[model samples]
Target: MFRVFKTCHLFKQNKIFTRRMAAVNLKSLSEDKIYEFLNSFDTVLTDCDGVLWMDMTPIENSPEVMNKFHDHGRQTFYITNNSTKTREEFLAKCSKLNFHATKNNILCTSYLAACYLQDLGFKKKVYVVGSEGVSKELEQVGIDHCGVGPDTIKPGVPYKTFERDPDVGAVIVGFDEHFSYPKLLKAASYLSDENVHFVGTNTDERFPMDGNIVVPGTGSLVRCVETCAERKAVIVGKPDTYISKAIIKRFNINPKRTLMIGDRCNTDILLGTRCGFQTLLVLSGVTSLTEVNTWKQSNSQDELDLLPDYYVDKLGDLLPYLEKFKPTNASATMLKFFSKSLRVSMAHMLANKENYERFATQRSNNSLLAVTYSLSYIRIDSKLCNQSHVTSANPSIIVPIRPDITEYEFLFTGNHTMAASNLKSLSEEELKRFVNSFDVVLSDCDGVLWVENEPIPGSPEVVRRLKLIGKKFFYVTNNNTKTRAEFLEKCEKLQYQAKLEEMMCTSYLVAAYLKEKKFNKKVYIVGKEAIGKELNAVGIEYIGLGPDPLVGDSLGMIENFNPDPDVGAVVVGFDDQISYPKIAKAATYVQNPDVHFIGTNCDNQRPSPNSNIFPGSGCMLRVIEAAANRKAVLLGKPEPYISQTIISKYGLNPERTLMIGDKGDTDILLGKRCGFKTLLVLSGVTSLKDLEKWKRSEDKEERDLVPDYYTDKLSDLLPMLSNS
Candidate 1:
């Protein structure tokens, strides 16, 4: 809520460190609570046209704030969200405005969308539907333009007639007031076609125009066309995907390091929150002092869905106050707690003001040095895939592309037994024959099946096509935690078919091995309760792992097998709550070689949305492996019995089957050792870099760990199957 007092509280409260604590238990507070909150945000996003100056004239303290950012090396940017101007034009304007913004720092609406479209392999006639300024912006991006000539729309007609092309793959909708009904109808007809993509420049119902409040903006025009076509277009303007991505790329700043600044709470802050950037709101522009709903009961609070990390009358005035700000030791946790209490996203102080002012700080409007999408959700083709797992190491060996690879030169390497990579170079019949030869189809889980819970591009379609063509396939994975049913349910959610009889998992074989041992004594489990549940179904007694009462009297399991010297094996699985005490006990128990020690699987880690990687079952295995200088038996994928468990369960002819996955160490090696064919697709973990590194390795196992075949993705498989 704004206070509209004409900056009357322009004076700082003396004894600011004595500000009342929301939490009373704290002994010392931040140096300056106001400065502390402001420090939470590291970057600022200011609009060029209005806030900087009403179209051009410098507003008060504009240069002061610019100089502050320059002096402190703080991340500051002038985001116009203006589609009318290109990057060069925006930089030129910044130069004219005396901010000295560069082409790399400033972001325009149309340019980002253009770059994304090119990246996405969209080749189509860009039908322009905006003013001459917007048309010029499109021309700067190398777009093959074909659309209505530059003119104002007729008084009654909201659009102009441009001859529609059936081959037009995309229609870029922008602001056009001098419109006609005929143009509107034609655009609607083309946009409604399923193949043609519809992209809007912006959704602002009105923008600052020649000193007048005009209703003629992209939002209103887009609504008219969308209403006519009964569809919504992908908005690519300010506070949208384009500008957010632009800020990411221009700043080279990770989402964690960037912040979005604006005056309007709904449009400005919400974009930052949703785009994974921190947000700051100044009580300067759209939302004024008292109009905000405070009770939290109204629809507007939920509807607007925006809140700033810090609230202030103006953004520029923040610098002068932060010099005296203090901080507490536990301020980090307090910050998250305070944000949750106030229903805001998390943020914290970035750097000291003097540090920013001394060593860095440039005055150009382009404070952002690097930019890109925080989350680049690319929908790639399926094939050579596995469960969604992240890599622990970053690439250090840089492979510079040179004359080694060129179009129509190389194909059918040692791994390309099916000659599928040569499809591009082959004739229609040759491609058909090659596809027909692929009787076996293998699939991975992560990028090909689903990145976590979401399925990859055409996953369902690829599976359906494989099924139709009577291609025998298998879902192979290295993650050995959950049993067969869990993996099947995941597949079902991704709209893929799975038979319980056809299921395979690493945990199943481990459970069977434990049952075979027939140890009559209590088995101390380190993994999930599900493993215990499986063990208990076979009349085995197992105590809980956590701080539950059941584990209270289970100390003797750590000592030598006392009860008739037949204590069962110590089974370790992926336990989310295994404590250090339990590990210390297990380490002591496994000292006797007579007592069998078993672990579920040896996966290094698992992926989660959390900041740190969850140490998987492999961490537990490593602890035991170090204690007993002998390798424990592995019963997971890439292992024989892991695949055999599914075969025994389904009673499938194992010799005729194939294993499909991306990782060479797990998928290809396992399939080759088991007398099964392996198929690799480039949709998941293993990339061209991995292939090059592995293929060039001197190790014998590494040299032999090649897939029988490889393809760019699984979607390519379906087209080949159809042609065959």
Candidate 2:
């Protein structure tokens, strides 16, 4: 028989029995759906500022409350959405509040946001919309910031606007009680109209006062402008995954095994629900038992997704609510929450904090259990694009009918992800099936097809498979500066066939777009002379930036050419004349932001035979883009320009396009971020090993980095497409 250790009040005289009861209570957790959810992870992630504490002090009993987790030997990382303070400051606050914390245990969003901006290549003049704290935080990362003071650009000030000068790139937002209509309107107008960014400090609606009322917080200001602009404010505050991710990055907290405990449902509960943590709502703070009772009574409460797994008056008071907490060691109650009966009740039971958190742990990644209770608008199973089959023994569990919204199914899954090779292995029937399900394909040159100028396994056969089937495909490569004729010739010599039009190298598109821009000045050609020939055809003069760049170099023109103001664009490509003299001159010209700095493409490097290591166009692009402190508009594969070209060439519909690639950074992320369904292939570039590292990261931006579908190789995906 299962031991029901209902309450600790029963064990005052016998410490051993109380210990036994604790174990028994833990056992009951496995048996009871709610207990299992509470025990799913051993780490707790919490946010500061508006979460655990207010401005200078913690919410009542927050320390004694958090001590319960510490006593359990669970890791606790205090994550803050604000960036102004360093770990030292956080630890000081923790000490003051009696919440145990070390520098390592604190993950600050200000720190992470600064790092994120840096990684995305931002280190320029910053326009901040917060107090001094926001500006000071960004400055630590060597980022220059100009605050919202009157001096930067005041009334009656003639400042440079976008059409006149586009250098003022970033606009960061934070809480400011002094936010006026004039200031708010300008921030909204600028952020909405151009590429200027809009980032917020946090999203807390109102801060809790010492009394019953709440004070409007920074989030209210952010929402006001964001609503006016019709743009989603990039939150840098609590409950934002970006902040939660800092714990994973700094302390290596596995999101799969983390829990968040707090009192308020809105802040603590929201963090737990969004950050993929087990949330325990303690009724010792602002939220009350009456509210829960009222929500249940009225049947009008919402955000059922964010409901906590367990409800207790306090951490020390949990022994009473654990009526179902402790059970016999052998009790199988934990598995009960995972039963098919749960899914049916999921839609209704979610609003009940006690019921929702219990079974949420049983949910698999990309499964409904984890997401069903978080964002109401997010369909947990929607990404899979398949009808969910009801589980066994839960025959009465009415599966929710699919909504009328556009349904998107995962294109490849299960065994289909294992057997595939390049897209060509698909039979004619398979080809039609793939084209039916997917509309675009991205192919590479080099090792994917040829190894050091020799055809690899299944070269022409793959090309013919696509040609015969007439599947829309583009030769997407990082190699820029080389013309279409060059890739086509290489294809013919290597026993693979490709047409000039079918070839979509970054080199040709960039050169063509530059030519069309009609800068009509001297081009500082950094790559081979052949690249210069194409530019020359567009009526632009080319000066050699190197010796013997393959396309053309007559009079040591590359090394000796002094850049003239007439030098419209310093076009950097893969250059063999990679001598010190060339690098210095090119770097000098790029630093002048007024000059047009162009790179062939953004690929860092590529592997090959003999020399084995050669710089890709991206490496060259980075050099110029960094010096200018601006993101170069890439004209290559999956970029809108390239996407447009590909779509127009094959008359392919953009919505139907599917980009298949092995690397998540370049291929999957590019395709998906560009609004195409992406299928990550394991055949080249990316691997399972890479995904393992990516998963351990706290970067929330990586969320979109996931592939719509994944496969060991492209060949395996054919069956799924054909079957679909």
Candidate 3:
């Protein structure tokens, strides 16, 4: 929310200063201030869905307030993040609801997406992972597209056998109730090509619906595609500035005088803030007053931008306020209010003993002073008292008349929390202390020691040095593509000394888990030969190791399909030859209450150095889960199974154990979940940008991803070790 202020005189010892008020309640303002506010803006941009109407129902007197805007000759535009409807459809809905909207006034994401592509002169067809609204808008702009309706997995046709359309040059993602496994596969496959443009309609996580039922929105589908594709899409809706650009291009309006109204803060209010528009938040939708207050106290500038200039219970509440201010008498009301001498009685009263004590008592909780004077208010945050002077007469009263103090000096203060740790900058003594503090080291294989088949520079030397220092090292990996022995061989080839007993691969873990359960039934596999080899090494019987391609139609395959009566567990890992038939078979077997479902890991995609994305086992696992309507028992990093096994087997103290990896979601999160100290190396999946985001995130899950220590790479530790 942008900070907005009406000019107010601050008379202190014949000195004056201007200050802004933010997140104010409009109804609390005096009649003159309200009249001034009404006359301030000529253009009004309001969000639909939650502000004007919810679904098909109009919010109380909202239509009256909007229609009044038209009566007063204020230009109105309906802006929405909803991508499910075209501009024509939106205009019709407006007409039906009596909001007095024209087709030109509607700015939905679907229309904006069309405008974006049209402006780019894109000629090729679009492969859409969305609804008909997106496709219809594209068609209106003379752009060809496909993949609008349901695209279910064909019985006889393997997913890999589906040919790529040569004409597809872009992939647009929006709201789609028909989102399925086949659509995900197609979108991911199309996005594999570097030339294909990916555009998402909006990033709204869910709809603002009342009741216990939660409706997932387009953002969920967009993120799913982004994960599987390993590419960030160009967002075309709120908080992206695309729609703002569209509005600016079409209308000649002053941003300073424009009023942007909405219910959601991240999207609607953020958009207004970015465009320098006055923002009004209504509590009839997603964001609440508690959230706004929380954001106000946040140290992050990103979260601060979500604050609105003013808020109300709902948009309809403004109708009564609007009724009081008529165009004929608005000027007279403002003039009459300004003609009177500004009062210092409120400030003078604060100087008295009884009044000061009462004021201090009221503000004791938050240490904040808010004094309302006439039509304006003054807020003095006691937290910013480092440089300011306190009056001798009253020690609690802050003197605001200092010659050097700027108007905004009291408002903006720097008070930051200390960072956890940065390993690269640690002194030699500190480094030695850190090394001696930990007895056991749990290191991720892929990102920490190596990326793919290549070892990271100096990683082997660091491992050798750590081992020489008597640190118990364990190669913890989520990679199920290789057996423990095979992983040990790779470690040896990479010049890192490791034993088979120290290698903790997911494949071996799965086999060990089933073996410990003492089950005699065969295992159904949806992975490569490594899982099969691991099971065989454990003297366990299994089937479905290699590719099981779909050969015929669904009805024919159903008649021929035979469920293995002896199969008691389904193990899923990385399979390069993963097909529709494999997923179908796995889903079918897992549907039975008796059959166990296990997944190697939930790592979305393998970290790649280039544009090409390698879909991880999690992608296959999700596809099978979606088809089966059941969750897999995951066995990997971030899950306590492997960590518990390591702790129990070695009898190691968790407080003295260190977990080091490059992925925050898996490795760092696992360390946090357990009692291990975490060190994040920015050599693989997680980067400095990701670290900063997690550090500032309001979500506890995102904050949990922050590691205790971080460095550019694991190789940087070699210098510290050598010095120590």
| Best candidate, TM-score | 3
What digit string (tens of lDDT, one per residue) describes model 2 on residues 321-415? 33334323322443442231112322343334333334433333223212232222234344332233322223432223234323322111111
Each model's lDDT comes to 0.54, 0.54, 0.77
TM-score of candidate 2 against the unseen true structure: 0.40
Q: Write the per-residue lDDT of candidate 3 for residues 118-189, one digit (tens) a residue.
A: 999999999998877899999999999999976765667755556778899999999776666667767887
State TM-scores per candidate: 0.40, 0.40, 0.56
Q: How far is candidate 2 from the true structure (C-alpha RMSD, Å)?
A: 21.5
Which model, 1 or 3, shows the larger lDDT?
3
RMSD of each candidate?
Answer: 24.3, 21.5, 12.4
Report residue 237 deviation for candidate 2 (angstroms).
Answer: 2.9
Give the number of the best model, judged by lDDT. Answer: 3
